[model samples]
Target: MAKIGINIATGSLQQEEMIVGIDLGTTNSLVAIIHPESKKPVALKEHNSSSLVPSIIHFGEDGAVSVGETARNYLVNDPANTIFSAKRLMGKSYDDIRKNASFFTYKVIDDNSDSLVKVQVGDKFYSPIELSAFILKELKTRAEHILKTPVSKAVITVPAYFNDAQRQATRDAGKLAGLDVLRIINEPTAASLAYGLGIHKEDEKTIAVYDLGGGTFDISILRISNGIFEVMSTNGDTYLGGDDFDHAIVMKWIREHGIDATQVEQDKMLLQQLRLKAEEAKRHLGQKDVFIDHVGKYQLQITTSEFEKLIDPLVKKTLEASERALKDAGLTTADIDDVVMVGGSTRVNLVKKEVARFFGKPLHASLNPDEVVALGAAVQAEILAGNNKDFLLLDITPLSLGIETMGGLMDVLIPRNSKIPTRIARQYTTQKDGQSGIKISVYQGERDLVKDNRKLAAFNLTGIPSMPAGLPKVELTFLINADGILVVKAKELRSGVEQAIEVKPQYGLTDEEVESMLMESIVHAKEDIAIRSLVEAQTEASQMIDTTVAFINKNREYLEEAEIAATTNAIDQLNQSIATGTKDEIQARIEALNELSRPYAERVMDLAIAKAMKGKKI
Candidate 1:
């Protein structure tokens, strides 16, 4: 008799069969999946492991990396090499973060340019993207170990207020971690899904999601209609969250104990210990009326009421953000059908009471606030995998659609797996001085370089009035209709020069071929991204050199002989570095050049302004 074959490892299941959902958060990260037996979304975990992974990474003397709880242990001992809060650097330049640079203990490179920022540890330089990838890779490994299966595809959640560049950075990090990111959903949307708000086709509701995480806060207003979720508005302070709440307690403790704040600041180990104690006290106060503790000779004691008072201003700030979101959405508090709480901070009694009072309704706190987003992402992943047919799964673009930009980089307009019948437009500017025409080349694939992707069509937007670089504003729009046909349009707003083209995005590609292309993209994702970064560095270096040359030529009379010679030497070093140096080397030279030229440029600008006002009346 032929007996039924039984597989001991996976119970007849094959590896690489499940798609997980990931919450790539600022302070922590987690992965979840739909349980095969229960048909419910659950965060993947083991008896010895945890659902949440502290989003931290540390580099050792030997250049080995550690992540999660293990890496978190290095916060005090190896603060310089232990990285946290890297998410704040995503898609930001040095100028954007200069004011807050003191918050980080590690050295953040200040190039004083518009180029993306980098962090330095010892002799190595790391971008936010690369740091974030280390965290993602850890989560991926954890999920795979827990599931006993290879996890390749994922649905990742981001803050609703993240701009296009921030979202793209997140996608690149996921790709670098060897995961094929199927969808990039908003955190608030994922929270709503976890509460089953948009699963029914006939359901219509408006909800407010108040997400207060460890390091950031965001309030998003969303409307759900017929299984579709749309973000109406979002408002919040990226630098405010539960961390500040803990800080309040720490300060109060220091004041009561007569401890020197400066002394605490100088001792990293003491500061980290106090922070941990403050966090512990906060959690204890959540369940009890008061918390009392001691650190050395300092006695820390606080009542729930006092804690509430300490955070009242912070809570008020959140309410103000929520008010702004509601006003931006053109809605009143009464229009909100549900109020969902997300993040561990929302578990505080004061937060709950204030949120309920403001909304005029009891909050939806039934679900675990910390894990709601991850669970919701799992539901979306299930839908993407066709495991949940009861919910509507909109048609998605088979591959990423983008246009070629300077340096031959494929700037994605619409990412893969985006819902169909969508429209998006972005503004662009000329790269060359007095440029009159712009070439728009559309492509379809996942690679960073346009040459690696399949070119769909090419068109030139001619007749644009000649304008200086960065002067003329050109709006490019991509509209994908119901039938999956793409219409690309370009309009120079200043000149009113318009051009458009229609193309069937899926022309000549079979389903098998599409799958093959996707697999190829995932397999080569790392190298593609590395090449893209190098090319971007090269392009930026070239632009800086050109700008410096133009400035020197135009202001030859204003510069001192020594200043001109110094600036010229710096510019030459930058050019040479661009030729053969690493990305970090090129960036270092760029910083040197900028440092030498900034004061001169400002002096010239002041002179021009003074001359213009010389004979004018006040």
Candidate 2:
């Protein structure tokens, strides 16, 4: 007999429904929950297995999918099909990550548009959200297997620097995983909670959380008071982390052994072996003075001092970022009451020693660095579940609020459980030339399709100056006040045309209705996402058709008859694909059309630019 789900120290019962806390990370992801027997947060895993799940995905030849360690195994051998670091691509468009696309081993679809980036595996295309969902699904399955219960709700954490689009992308991923995301908190906040730093109302202090993971480093200064944690400023390098430390070791060995870099680059398996050995050497040197290993006849050896020296600059880079963060927050080292350590990289002795020397305080490293964020997420989940009554929240939105998108899909502007008196703004554009008016329709629900949601309000902002499609930027801002009054504002930033509407967001929906809506969303998550994908594909295809037709009409005089006929034929093919193709088919046809028109399109643009620059000096 055990006192499960009870706060032993407080003599209060915790929620019966288990809400797991998740750390959806760039290199690794894990799930944690309050161990009912011990009444303490713990990362969940099977007997003798490590808690971490690699944030990687692989698609089989038959199109079957695998995630975590299973997928990590394919990264070297089948690099073309294995996808990793999807967290970096979350909410990013092709233009955003095009420069860094080579970092990923898999093929990222180059739609060359502002829409979110997608990964291609053979004939299949996957969005970052979908890729992340696969990882979450694996985590959920692991949690259920270990806990022997159905885990449906979770509180996921992201970096403090994550933007609204990235956060919303995470929420959508959770939904697609069939989990009702209770809340999305910052990783630093979670790390602080894991250390029990901000649970008490009287605990007023400013602490610095330094998180250095496999692929990124972040330093966040948080001010805690009255059980609320506010991030004053966050700064870090997205590309500097534990992996760089490993690479530093690898380079030392490579230089010593005189291994040809070109040969390693040509062989993916050899490169992976070297990288893996380097990682092993890094860990080995952590406890021992020296590491000795071999990677396919290449002797790998590095002293702890050598390892520390190589990574000194990278660690210094993180400290430099910390300095910038403190400066941005208007604080000094003396002002930081506590320095909390986070991420697996902090396990390195040099990293810990340098940080302590700089901060002038003993670091908080009692808890497992790898599991700190997930454990803190569990604490946040407990708080969200009303199990821990240490804090209270203000009036919140029960259902998600969003506007309708191109495919009758609900594009959530404000997610549920968001604290009111908040504002969110998103940029949109015209679909056709001289489109003088754009309708703004708002809805409230958890469903993906707008038809399944409750319409809150609608309005049209007219008198937009006539311009070609996609030239005018229409920014929609949603302002929700303390009284649950939602003010919707649509402004064409270029034209200076604006409109606003005030609506009572809460139309007297009962608790049961809210509960029912949430439950339905989870139950229908997969099908809803499938429908959303199809509708979105169609919408994109239709827009491409319109833009291409417009381009042809405007530049007809500059084109040859054969080029015009080829463009027309490509358009027809795309249109037919939109009518009868699956999402992948539609995308392939779109790419084909793009290839057919890109040459002349670029030439026309160059001529236009040349004419505009005629007789003009630099």
Candidate 3:
């Protein structure tokens, strides 16, 4: 029988039921189930007992695929088939992808996808949502498998810097993955939850979370007291992160080694190898004073001092962002109770040292930096489930929600840092003589020029009884919900005719575009699965061969030579089938290979048991 994995269905479950909280990070993702009784959040474990799944999805040639840890292993070798760090591209355009092409290991292609960046993997294209859904789906499965029940309600976290379109895209991805996204919590806020969950004081204390993750950076200043978390201010570079720091290290490596990587893009394999090398050096410098390596054709050894020197400028950029966040919050460093460090990037010794120098206090990383956001999310889930009665979180909009005015100036309505579930009203007048309709363009950003910011949507104030210039008065109000989605409405003040404005986001997927993308993804899902399964089957076959080799040494007296020969033959056939990228053949050979190695697996288990018994006897 072909096994099928059951997924958690979407929507609100029974009221008072425990809700799940997810940290959908750029480098990794985790799902935690809140215990209704204890109000504790437990990170869900995979089928094989691993938590904290890597945010990677590998597409195979057969109608089979793998995600998370198994998929991340295929990244360096099958860069084309494996999509990693796609979180940065969600809701972004081809133009944005082009600007940071050098930082990625995959091929960012300009395809016929209506100006949206389409990731070309081998011969197929995948939208960012589809890729992200695969990751989300994997997390959902892990949670369902762990709890033995469906996890319907969840709060997903995103970078505070994600714009309206990006947040919408994230929610859409959650929907596609069949999870009811109760809320989209900002990453920094989630970190605060992890830090301040059990603390409730009468007086408020301002805390800051400096979250520099794999593909994005965010600095959020939050105020907390008596279980209320109010995000005071937030600032970040959406496109910046630890990946950029690694790129700085890579460029330095090239200069120190006298090798040029500007031309390495022509050779995708070498580029992939170099990126892996660069990443290793960056990680190494975290623990050691020096790094030594030969990354394919390039041979270079870099001292920690040299690497730090190269990345000092990038670190400075983060400091500048932190300062901006503090200024935005109208607070000084002394006002902060603690500066919390979240994200694996905080492991960098230099990052910690510099943060301490800037803040005049040693950075706090008491919680698992990688898991705090997810843990905090779990706390939110508990609160949402009515289990944590004392908790209430108030997340503010990261960017000013506004509209384009005359001469392309931004007419901000609801400024950044405004509390959620708030509304602001603005009055609009007729543009010119006898103007029948007033076209209103909505934008979101801190930019002074409309062109420099993101165009959220545009709608018209119509049915204006065509009066002479300056005679009509139209009232427009932008209401932001708790979810942070903007709702715009306009009313002809004199005529009392009101119409809800429908504005299309500049880089957002329209209804038709989304439908087309789903169809395309469905059609291509099989091909991608096939390619990935072929590689995975071969990898499995190789591991089986190694295990058999070890098993034969211990059980040679009990096994027949022909049994060993058959196992070897089956593995060879599977390896050969993997190269052909034939899904059916690979599946058949893999099954045969697994069958042939079953005896050896059992024998190895027996041997381990016998050794344990011997130890007990001693």
Candidate 4:
């Protein structure tokens, strides 16, 4: 007897696999796929329902997880347990978000360290990766339900200005959600693809993508040739978007109604309600000339002219960013063949007029702005699956390449899916004073820690002149040839000591073996991330303990007994936490120790400076 695979939901033969395209957006998310029958990209949706899914997550008292419209309802009544705008938090540290911390309604832990930030709800801590995973999982489930097939592979889109860490975080989220992310493409590029800008081999054109999403705005200049799209330059304010337009209305209403600003600031629920009203007004003014509403004793009315005037400054900001992008790309507005508008906010009449005036051309917004990216992603997925043979797809590296650095962290030199035959160099330093030798261990994977990845090769560069730590510069260069062979070279700049190694990155590996390795990596993605975080926390704690002990021993005479005792106690607590506690617990203890020692360290530096100045003459 032969075994036949079948889909339980649709009773169809599960023979051909489907790869989906996903728009994991800040305000909303959705999935799209190429229709096998029509040969067109269409967003997956249920009967008579819209495609957009609110990118919100809510945790209930029973520890049940909810997403989309169900979770959006909890924003006002259970704000602390709900997470939104998680894309803004991706790959960011506490210091990165300190200035805008109040923008979030939930608690964001402030450990003052350089590690990724975490949100606290009740007693549970969640990283931005985990939060985003919930959204992706929701989209995956929806695609599976609508297509009646098991969806496992996807191509996700991101902003053109997103850094490497942010892109990696998105990939990790997809893996955690049980999706094998085949590629991470720029949202601007995806938008252009949806408009059929890069499908022809002879089509040579320069285009501009002006995207104004719910929480961010960016303008990108791109050049397309022979079905290849390359971003020339990108610029925008990550903190400015349509949300600010709503905020402008709220401020205007407060001024007109003579509402107590202090009272509104103190009441989160009331503030949320006003924000919702402002959003409604913004949407209503798009089609009507005026909006009228009353909440409590305050009557609010906003006209189209007033709404346009309030957002003029923001519109001008986008134009300025466009000018800068053009300047950086060394191209004038005349060089652009087309200008594309993306995001729901672009539907505003004023925005369209201003953008047209700036570019001196009509806009390309024929498709729904909210769904264009997902549609393009679906097209890219089609190409990846070899179903669309008209467009040429370039070869890409299968895994990330990096070297082991201090604290056992994997500092990526070349990210995965990068164009082939590329070379990049980075500088590193010795961690110990008078260190004469350095070991270069190369690894391949997506994990932050080197231990969780596959070791490719290792070499040692010896003979460095005795110098203080961080004085010796070691330049490491990675070059991948046309045949996918990697050559790693390391050289001590000051001493002229060099070492080199060659490894065939794709040697002796069958296609099935590679697939198995990819599957295993995705299967263990969450655990790998957790282990990496714990190791980093432990490394930081150990380093802090050593430094504090050394400082106390050397400056005993400058410190009071009570201060020394407190500092010692804090160090002891941190060590204990490092032994058995979670990353957040260990980080909290480390922060406590820093708070206890910072003042004394500053005082000691001040006294030393004073004594030195006393002996010297001006």
Candidate 5:
């Protein structure tokens, strides 16, 4: 009854059989579904539970991984193996991680190819994408259980400041999870959708989404009208978030304890506990003014006002970001119609007050600070699913995309803030006499130095005949689609010699790596199932043996020799299967073995319960 279909008009998926929306956040990730019957969005939760899953993953002894809420609990005891706030490293290079290593609890391993941030979970190493997929899988499992159907298609949201490689990495992650990502919408844009603002139909109002979440900050200005929501401009730090606020508080606590601030990672477990307490303290202060004494393995006390003073600098940084967003939109503070605050970090009373003072307008508190982005993503999912009849939203590239020129300079092709699905073309020439080959380097960012920016890809333009310098003119065309990914082409103007250039991103994982990782995951899943079956079978065999022994002892007088032999034979067969190579194969045998001797096992359980009840009566 469910199928994947594309919209011929919009050039994106028209609708999917399971058109779910996911807000893959820095602190948390959520999966929600729009009820076809009720036409309302409902976030999926685990069975027999109403609480949302936390975005944390813990790898215990023996390659065991616990995701979500359980993983957060594991963090209290195990700091090295518990990975939280992983969304901060998504799409970032190892160099970038190195630059900010002082702030993180996990170690960024740069010796690995392409420099990966490896979380030492127990004895294993995991990439950020791998940890994120664990969270995604947990969400997927909950959704499938609630819907009683497999969910394969989704609309995922990312920070608006994400560049091409980052967006591509996200898509790759969805693929790794066996999901057909219909589209990647910007988080702020999704928040606007949650507001149900009139901007979608073109009201010509300038709206800003001040989004500061667990690990990233993004502020986007949008022009809404006639059902088209266009992002005018955007800017923010990918590594900024409430996590930093917690760190600031923890730093103050460390200073109070007479510990050097630079040695936070030396005793990671202690620092982790302090961070957890600091986070709790910040959340409590949002609702009340008093400070709580948070005693971990070590004693520490923090006041609410002191905590605010420590985070005051970070707050100012965000205010500066808001100013930049307004400036980029070519508008003053007065031009902002309504500032919509999103992200859990915005829950702080100080943050709200500061925003109001800076914008000089009352903050619109109508949207759920924690869930707006996810809700907006669901609305977009409905539209993509062909269920929404109201309007469509269009977003633009967040940065200037260009190619490299002579002397390592960048030649801007499509400037930032260009409408979706735009194209640009440029010409190149032979630089020397008898030049037989040419090279083109494509890049992205607003930097003057090519080395300072992101290298999207590079391809060689070869087979040019021996010619005088500057004689051969090769026209290069760079095209950016609605999703912000790029495609480049080169054609000789005079001879019409042309070729499509394949530009590999400078810092992103290659297709080969993704494929290898996926294959490894399938193998891991298979091994897990086998191990679980073995454990289950072994437990069942032991239980059957114990039951048979007790039953024989209790009814020795009535038990026939034939019945005793049959029970012993069944238990032996199950034990043999547990010892064999294939656990699932053996587990299947255990089920059959149990069926053969059920009367004996059931009778034993009943007798045991009767004995317990008899003792209670006595």
Candidate 6:
């Protein structure tokens, strides 16, 4: 009774409509879809091109953006403009990355304050969301070019340990790429799905996924029962992966040939060449007994045994992480029904053997490790589209439902493509001293900032007893009934004050408007990001000014005439910058104010402490 559509080019079956699956990996990315006739997942690739698209982005002198292999070539030539490993920065603040900032070649804007990290490229600022969107956009275009039809929706996979903010950022990246991200599933779950570990309704298995990618490694233990997959625990090193293996080989050559370390460090091109050659050697050793190559007239050779010996410690590190994951999951190797091997690094014979030995069983790696996650994503897409009977959520929310918080950011409670009749709740607190009220603004859209999204409804929960900032615990709840109605409720637990509102969250927009909003977000991503950075900086500056004024007013007697005059001047300067200055200028002024007031503030604190201890007991 139903007509099925098949993609003429790649044969992706369409049940009503087609949806693709994407693996947005840290080092590489790819797209996959279910084959129309065979009904099996396959990674899509153009003739003569590898399905793996390097997750790299390059900004040209003319302001054009390039992704994948083309961008990868510029990593050394134009390190300042090429962005890679952006996945590590998603949802991370400046303080989270300062210690390892040098790992990135590009300039990461460090405000020294806890703000979302950004990349400064040629006077323009870009967020990790924008950088990742460029890669997703490329994948979308490549899929469209192959399928000969528009690809507008996808299910993207993230690492099992990704938090709520990271997951939402990935969704926003998809929206910016013009894809209605159907879901953000865990990588381990996708890997299990790719291996058909949980496809059947009766299948019950506890699987472990060992994912060793180009630059990082993760081991996830999962529990699957009745076709539902849950990630029990995830553990791994963010710095250990194939890249480390390559570096091990590189260091070997350096020590063997007596090459000057300083020389290699000075010459970026030569260093990159050596690394590439090392990578090539690592891949070659996977298929051959030995790898023989040359990097800039220096002979490079490594037997499989030698290579294995060099990386045995690295492999053990993964096994250690697996044990930790198993321990955290409250399981053991004997309990794991299947061990799914993922990532190109797993293709190495030594890695496969060590993992199998550690698990006391053979590994499941029939599918291409690099493509497995994407293929699993295709299965998820099929399920989400109602093409598969094993899983069904007939009525769903078309867009994400979220509430706006401080700095005008949207924190999504119910993501897009979520099943209906969902109830979700998150806690919040006041941002200022003695604040007695909190406003909950509901929004529906895919943009990161609330201003770019459409407001659904708003309500205030007042009568909270005055308390210092962050002392009041306010809980917000969103309940979407099966009838497509949304009820937003807010309650201050300590004060027992509450408010509720019911409204149709999808009332205002047509399908065209939704698509246009996504397109507009992509078109104005740069401007929107710049404005957001400025607004965030201004907000921080304004708060600093207020705090500084309060301190001055309360402690004018403890301050000298010169100290009071200097503090006032700093406050006025910060205010002026907030009124009319760029994000960088505002941040700079805030730093200056903090520096100028640090001495006086410390002096006042010491005076108070001394007064308090003046006549206290020993």
lDDT value, residue 578 of candidate 3: 60
How close is every model to the real structure, measured as TM-score?
Answer: 0.94, 0.95, 0.60, 0.90, 0.62, 0.84
Candidate number of the best TM-score: 2
lDDT of each: 0.89, 0.90, 0.72, 0.87, 0.69, 0.87
Candidate 4: which pairs clash?
A: none
What are the root-mean-square deviations of the candidates from the true structure over C-alphas?
A: 2.5, 3.1, 22.9, 3.3, 22.2, 4.6
Candidate 6 Cα errors over 4 Å, as ranges: 1-16, 406-410, 420-427, 444-459, 463-541, 544-618
Model 3, C-alpha of 15: deviation from truth (Å): 14
**What TM-score number comes out for model 1?**
0.94
Q: For candidate 3, write residues 321-425 as lDDT tens digits.
A: 999999988999888887889988888878889998888987778877878889889877776665655555456555556777555656567755455778888
Clashing pairs in 2: none
Runs with alpha carbons beyond 4 Å of true place in candidate 2: 1-15, 505-507, 609-618
When 1 and 2 are scored with TM-score, the better candidate is 2
Model 4 worst lDDT run, 10 consecutive residues: 6-15
lDDT of 4 by residue, 1-618 (tens): 866667665565553789999999999999998877678888888988999999999999999999999999998889889999998899899999999999898888776566688887766677898899999999999988877778999999999877867887898889889888888899998999889888878989999999998988999999999888889999998888899999999999999988899999888777888899999999999899999997777898999999999999999999999999999999999999999999989988999999999999999989999999999999999988998888887778887788987778877788776777888887788767789999999998766678877889998888888897668999999999889999999999988888999988655657676677677777777787677668877877887787778888988999999999899789878988988899878867876797788899889989989998996888
Worst 10 residues of 2 by lDDT: 6-15
Q: So what's the TM-score on candidate 6?
A: 0.84
RMSD value for candidate 6: 4.6
Backbone clashes in candidate 4 total 0
At residue 440, candidate 6 shows an lDDT of 85
Poorly placed runs, candidate 4 (over 4 Å): 1-15, 59-62, 78-80, 122-124, 405-416, 424-429, 445-454, 463-475, 491-499, 598-618
Kindly provide the TM-score of model 2 when superposed on the true structure, using C-alpha atoms.
Answer: 0.95
Angstrom error of the Cα, residue 118, model 6: value is 1.1
Scored by lDDT, model 2 comes in at 0.90
Instruction: State model 4's lDDT.
Output: 0.87
